[model samples]
Target: MPHSPDDFAPYAHTSLPRLLTTAHLLSGAPGDHREPTELVRRTLVRVCARWRRIPRDDVDFYVRRFLVKEYLRGSRGRARRAKAQRAVLVLLHWEGLREAEIAQLLGWSAGAVRSRARRGLAVHGDDAEHLRGLFAKAATGLVPLDVQLDAVEQRGRALRRRRRGAVAAVCALLLVPGIVFGGNRFMTGGSTDGSGGGAADVAQSPTRIVAPGERVDAVPGAQVWLTTDGKHWSTPEAPNQFLGLTDASAEDTYRNKYQDKYKDGYGSGRKVSVESGKPTVSVQPDPLNNTSYFLSGLYRGLSADPARVEVTVDDHRITGTVLTLAGSPGWGVWYARAPLSPEELKASSVDGGPTVTVYDAAGKAVARGGAAE
Candidate 1:
């Protein structure tokens, strides 16, 4: 029942770009010469081992999905996790996956998928029409196909070298006297945080979500435990404060983005809203103490208290966490307390830079607005 290298030949030949592209994204090295290869090298080992289990119905689907998951496995933090999800969405969409289909595969509703993709690709909207363009091109322009293939092969060599190095390390460890335990930990990639993923582990530091419109430093009785400007600190509470984790108004963000679209009949018959709501973005508290803060916003002109709302800003997409049912009668509210920082917002705030967009539960465009400066 063991599968052979022959079983993976097809994937290498046809999906090389996707594999390389995903590796590049996950590694955060779109231009790196070696990271992509290392990722491909590692992924191929998994694929070959599991070849027999890969579905016969759509080999490409399973293969590509597997690649993304493998990359995510090595990634660190919730922010990185969200980034990985966004990259996967854009990459898969770039690879011709249908909006609804991608949504289902990723555990997202069809509507959420559309909204995420639209915002992620808002900068690439023009080029997206040409489906035949390679996925790598979307991120790094057209990398030569041969170059991609070369990286895949290079990974094998690097992995073999790593194995030999690991063995040498183990041999050295045996000769050392009192350092055995410490050496073993190092070899296994153990870390001080205990998760090996890094400092962002939620177990070590839980987020203190400020309520919408509440200043981070102004949390009642909470002194400055964290700070970006060095002068200001969130609560000194280890489990309570973190910086710039997104605070949004589910309703305001929606209204600011879509109010104008609806009135102009952007997708009139299909229910597109251009109505401007001018949603206010803030870092606020989650009374439940679950996340950093609800990135909450109140928006006007929602279509039928949408079952879901998707908010995309900067490089992150947040699905509504708490919804206020028509609090202002005709207003729709949505919010998510993200772990992102205030510095992170500056990247999305430049003119013609990234903008925030909101979508209805059905994947229809509700509204969009520029990121606050």
Candidate 2:
């Protein structure tokens, strides 16, 4: 039986913003307008098709799981850490889900959830609350409700038509003698990955942008690859390393709204500096690769010439990769994976984190900040 458009409109109207926000965070590109909207639209179309059949108490959970699966589908080429970090962060912070619930949703053990959540929170403390505020502020200018509802209806209708056509084709084939269809092998929407949503498809890669007539030089034996656009990149070792990029805008907006919040000595422990073209640094553990941590941040407001960013992890200095996109995106992405042992991670938890320094082409240190203990 088919569900009516009227039946789903009310729920969609109320839930769309949060759903959109979740999708934005999970997609690892909150600043990119199209990816988040497209993700929510696809997930909602799926929900609208089966709205009546879903249990009322479980609708929110079901929709979140569905949205996660949809994100994983297109994220086949991403590294395991990239995928796991996003899932754990959004579920723990944004959705207010516990470790056990997130375990069931992602097919991981409760211990795994606890371990990752603890490590993630160690670095991204209070980020979710600030991010939610910025997203809510941005949602004030979204399109009218009727237009959004109509779009969902049209997509739902198209989906049903295709499903009916597939059924008819299957039935027509069934008429042949001695023919049998087995398992979900004949099903059109079966999981592309063999793990049944536990992993991603091996055939597809994350979407990369390459401008025509532009020459791109490949970095020899590089673990990370950046597109010519500079706005996007891929980390094969820990795909979720890039997830930190999603929080950039939210952090910036929060600083603007509370420009004088930390000027007094009351909250001296936390460092909140306004953007004055100086480099910022964020370091967090890679859940999938336990021995390594991701170090990344924006390098805007620096000299237009090539700049060198370096990080001193307990006196071991490493040169970082800095990406400045074409058309002057104001800020560019800079990152490096610092090797850390269990002993070091434990010690760093007590001491401060790494020290990051940015130097221009002239070898002069321009900006410096870190989790100074």
Candidate 3:
């Protein structure tokens, strides 16, 4: 497959800033120890090498998608999985790709893609402020524009040498009749199961959370939040674990969502508050019953024990208590479990899992999170 110089040149030169912006945000910093230019140079090299296979229209979009997707995956055995859901959302709403296009790119259903994007936006709050912060920072990095350009050019030349060496090796291998044809070309196309083009941990699983409990508005430690969809229900599982509800559609969506943000039910740990450490919030399927996701993570800092925690699903506030497994506080994990009413599911999906307020033993509003910050 061959591409004209005209096609390769524009995609290489024009797409660099967009690619750099995405790379900067996802990688926290672009390129290597001595040079950050490698990120841009290698991406351009890969896009050019695979130019023939990639469709021409929206070529820049495809390249940007590939750059972020592959860069998030990194090169070693352990891939970077943090904030993957946000990255995918950035590709969808931020990058302006439609639901159908995202589905085509990631091998997901249009409905499912829409569903996940909605959920992602709900958690992270889709807004221009985040983007403003992103590009604002991108402007400052990579000083001395001439030197940066020179570094990119130098890396591009080095990449060409490596690619040529690879081609020669392939040619030599072809000379032997019995050798298997496993082409390890630097170029690759998108994968259907989302392993190739989407941002996710390839081996990620779904996380589970309990619905808001009785006697309490939201459990003292509401680990995860679920929209008010009644297609789900609760059931018992382990001594201290929550395997309460299950939904097949959510199961599929969770698999597609990637990365386990709230696998362990929220507030399962000893630390009730965090001064420095950012704990993980995953949504995983219940291993015991293949049903619901448990608590995700701390949405706000709370007192030693909030007698009651309030959760807002769809805009309606639901009060839940710190439910102890089998009425034993020794279970040590308090959770808020609320399943949305049918009428509310749609709205909850758009606005789920945000804490309304936490109450002390005397039932007073604990001012924190949201606009308070």
**CA RMSD per model (angstroms):** 20.6, 20.5, 21.3
By descending lDDT, how would the candidates be arranged?
A: 2, 1, 3
Off by over 4 Å in 3: 6-11, 27-38, 51-55, 75-79, 106-116, 125-154, 157-161, 164-168, 171-175, 178-373
Per-residue lDDT of model 2, residues 1-373, tens digit only:
2234576888888888788767766766555778778878888888877675554544676688778877777455446666777678778876789875676556455667878777766665647576556545555555432227788878877887788899999888875542354433344343322223321211111122233111122121122333322222223343212222334443344334334432221111223233565544433223225566555544445555334566666756666666554454434555666786645644654445566666554455566755551
The model with the greater TM-score, 1 or 3, is 3
**What is the RMSD of candidate 1?**
20.6
Candidate lDDT scores, in order, read 0.44, 0.54, 0.41
lDDT of 1 at 164: 72
Judging by lDDT against the true structure, name the best candidate: 2
- Name the weakest run of 10 consecutive residues (lDDT summed) in model 2: 198-207
Q: Is candidate 2 or candidate 3 better by TM-score?
A: 2
When summed lDDT is taken over every stretch of 10 residues in candidate 1, the lowest stretch is: 224-233
TM-score of each: 0.33, 0.41, 0.36
lDDT of 1 by residue, 1-373 (tens): 2234465567666767767766665555566647667666666665554555454444665566556666666568876556655655555555667764464344344456667666656555635655325444546673643334445445544665677799899988787864754565445652321223432221121223322222222233332221111111223222222222122233243334444422322111111223354332222222223233334433445444433344454456555532332122234334454554434433333432223344443344455543332
Question: Which portions of model 1 miss their true places by more than 4 Å?
Answer: 1-6, 10-14, 25-28, 76-78, 123-373
